[model samples]
Target: MTGLAGIVAAETRLSMVDGENGRLIYQGYLAKDLALNYSFEEVAYLLLYGKLPSKTELHGFQCKLAENRHLPAYLIRILNELPEDMEVMSVLRTAISSLGRSEFGWKPNIDQAIRLIAITPVIVAYRYRQQHNLPIIKPSDNLNHTANYLYMLTGEVPKDVHIRALTVYMILTMEHGMNASTFAARVVTSTHSDLASAIVGAIGAMKGPLHGGAPTEVIQLLDEIGSLENAELYIRGKLERGELLMGFGHRVYKTTDPRAEALRSITSELIGEDAWLDLAYHVEKTAIQLLDEFKPGRRLYTNVEFYAAAVLKAVEMPAELFTPTFTVSRTVGWTAHVIEQADNNKIFRPQSEYVGEIPS
Candidate 1:
């Protein structure tokens, strides 16, 4: 059936994607409330461990993540050997495979999950630096996950605003029902596979443009529009010409994505009237108004990708690193799903309907 649309193939208590209501719930806390109140680490702990942590447990969890952030020398060498032209997602997947193989485990565990989540930023940082000829930076035990990732990328202590903003993004995106990558992860885990194999397969799924790669195209669209004056005509022209706007719609949310609403506040706080931010806001309004006029009854509201572009650009994140950065947060959800699947232990075996004429 059309990409398994409307089919409930599995069960979960991790996160809920309430598409009709345009709400995302991570373990009973509303996604927007989590973004506004909780740190990424707390939310990650909530997703995996099934509840928020105590102060001491939070400290211990932070220490575990900080302790694992440094990659082995050979992994760094792998980053160096990767060609500049190679897709970063492939390198990331293979590097994860290498990391997984180095550690021998057949079943899912918290340690495996922690290491995968912690080390992903390091992998992304080293490779991104190597490609740009920037100096590689080490992880700091002093910093939290978001700050540490920014420091590793920029080789400077990150600003508080950037860390806070990205922490919201991480929390909002950490888990959301059975997304493609999460499904891929659970499917692999159901076969009694290694943790790395499952994560590797998940990464391969996320690399597709229809899934994780949409935000970079949002960057391109915003750039092409360029100014507030250009927004209405530019958007209306694209609508009239039957071209799709990258950030205006989603397969899930029937109204404004809650994550988008959360990020709009972050973007406003960080951008503070920048020209591109202004233009993006205007484009959003004009696109919404025009979509109602042109295609009636289509919900077509602003989804997370729209404000994700704005928030990332406000933090000075390069367009190319967008999806890879997504991996850093999303790994938490994938690992949690793997553990859940391993606990339940069912091999996914869906039957395909045969339509071709059989030779009898």
Candidate 2:
């Protein structure tokens, strides 16, 4: 039972991670398809409500999300008071924890889920702008979820290309099968805890490097390689030295990550628009070839974090905001799991084996 590696903890109607086959499904739709064709709000609605929303329903949902995007004055004041030296993730965890008031208590519902999902990006943007001494941008009623997030961060209406790229990233990452953060959310919800409390726990788990830090590392790897010409040499040197290529493999996917494939397809269409993405496409090709030559039978391929780094960088997202952006997308999944866990509640109490023996 170490790390519960093979244990099936709980049943969920959310996204399915088919690592053996390199597919991800949300409710019933292919996550790749959803990312390629749907809006962030649409896919998020699907995860939270168990189906895609009709036009009217989507409009209402969009308005509800937009309406809730503003932070309370008290939360803003609290964000201002936090130390500048604190990690953004720590600030995010603390800001989210502060929302665990009476209204967010047991039996979490869609309204609460919507509120949490809508406000997470705002919280991150607020803290980010505050740290940089930039004026906080209010959420735009006209823009969709993904667009508004970029707008809030940059104080400009993002280009359609950037929005499309980031929307695909967000939709694809909105959920996966039970990972660390989702498990933490469910574990808290099993106690009939508030949604905010569960989300706070989830954010704490996501702050861990093993869980949410890959995209930043991938960015670093891309930066070091710097160009298509260096791709082969940089990657070959790393492999020759027995260093792990940050974005080329995944623990879950034995084959190519479907999310990565989908992102590659989208970024390919906009190839010359962003150099980082163009370089990523080249680098991935070179790395796969090098990986096969250097580590025979390893079956290493690009994971989602590979192109996630490219997309975020193309949109001018700072490296520090990488995991926090991931958090914003994953909040949809966390709240959905919280609601599901509340429906069929079970307090998690796994037994730990004791290896130490009494002195004889």
Q: Considering every candidate listed, which one attains the maximal lDDT?
A: 2
List model 2 lDDT by residue over 1-360, tens digit each: 369988999998897889999999999999999999888999988988988999999999999999999999999899889999887899989988898898797789999999999999988888899889899898888888989999999999999999999999998888988999999999998888899999999999999998987577888898999988988888889999999999888889999999999999999999888787899899998988999999889889999988999999999999889999999999999999999999999899988878888798
Model 1 worst lDDT run, 10 consecutive residues: 267-276
lDDT of each: 0.86, 0.91
Q: What is the C-alpha RMSD of each candidate to the true structure, in Å?
A: 2.3, 1.7
TM-score (C-alpha) between model 2 and the true structure: 0.95
- Candidate 2 stretches with Cα past 4 Å from truth are 240-242
Q: Which candidate is the best by TM-score?
A: 2
Q: Please give the RMSD of candidate 2 to the true structure.
A: 1.7
Clashing pairs in model 1, backbone N/Cα/C closer than 3 A: none
lDDT of 1 by residue, 125-185 (tens): 8888888888878889999999999999999997787788888888888887888999999
